[model samples]
Target: MITGIDHVQIAIPRGQEELARTFYGDLLGMSEIAKPAALRRRGGCWFRSGAAFLHLGVEEPFTAAAKAHPAFLVDDLDGLQSRLVEAGHECVRSDGEIEGVLRFHTYDVFGNRVEFQQLCELG
Candidate 1:
């Protein structure tokens, strides 16, 4: 039996750690966590916010994950959307297919799709 997801790994162009930090850390509100010494030489970075962990690994001739993505649960969906828009990131609102849940999709600095969602109070 499986427990839970350890982390979501995303591929990025080589030497783009600073860009990842700005997008995932400064913009997304996640904090950069040091990679293990052995893995540090591989040139990548990790970030964590609460229980959600995202790892960005360096890849040569990288291709963006435009379809596959990780959906993050947020408390303040509207506020987050506003912040992302204010920073020039487009927050594409999701269609109301899933009931009582609000979500939007946005691309990271590397063009990987990321989803943010919030549970709505069903009256």
Candidate 2:
């Protein structure tokens, strides 16, 4: 039986940890978390923002994930949109058909689609 997601992983080219740190950490405000001792040698990074966790795994010949993405819940969609646009990253507003939420989509350094959403009370 399924309960909840533990974490989401995105494959990135090897030796690109710096870019991941800049995007997920500096830009998005996620804190970089240390990988376990055994996993440390593999070369990648993990990040945490509140309860959300994202793992950037090292993949040879990495291909960007175009359709599949992880949607993160946020408190202020407008503030995030401003932050992202000011940082020069394109944040495109999604044409929402989902009830009670405002959302947008953006790409990481490696072109992985990342979604941010804020829930609002439905009329």
Candidate 3:
């Protein structure tokens, strides 16, 4: 049987592990998780938010993922956007909001596109 998405990995330029930490952990507020011994030498970082996980890997001749991305749900739209900007990252507004949801997109330190969304509370 198929289950929900476990994790997603993004390719990044080599030696950009710190950048991944800054954006994914410090700025995005995800907790860093230690990679298994077999994967440690590959170079990258892994983060977790509850059961959801994401991995950023380093590679030569890295290519930016313009279309592929991982979307994160947020509680505060404006606040999160402001915080990202304060951290020196650009948050771009996405066209056509889903009914009862506010959405936006941005790029991570490795230039991978990410969608952020806030669901409207039903009264």
Candidate number with greatest lDDT: 1
Q: What's the CA error at residue 90 for candidate 3, in Å?
A: 2.0
lDDT for position 50 in model 3? 75
Sort by TM-score, best first: 1, 2, 3
Model 2 Cα lDDT, one tens digit per residue, 40-61? 8999999999999999999888
Best-performing candidate as measured by TM-score: 1
2 or 3, greater by lDDT: 2
Candidate 1, residue 24: the lDDT equals 93
Task: Report how far off residue 4 is in candidate 2 (Å).
Answer: 1.4
Off by over 4 Å in 1: none
Indicate the worst ten consecutive residues by lDDT in candidate 1. Answer: 91-100
lDDT value, residue 70 of candidate 3? 88
Model 2, TM vs. native: 0.95
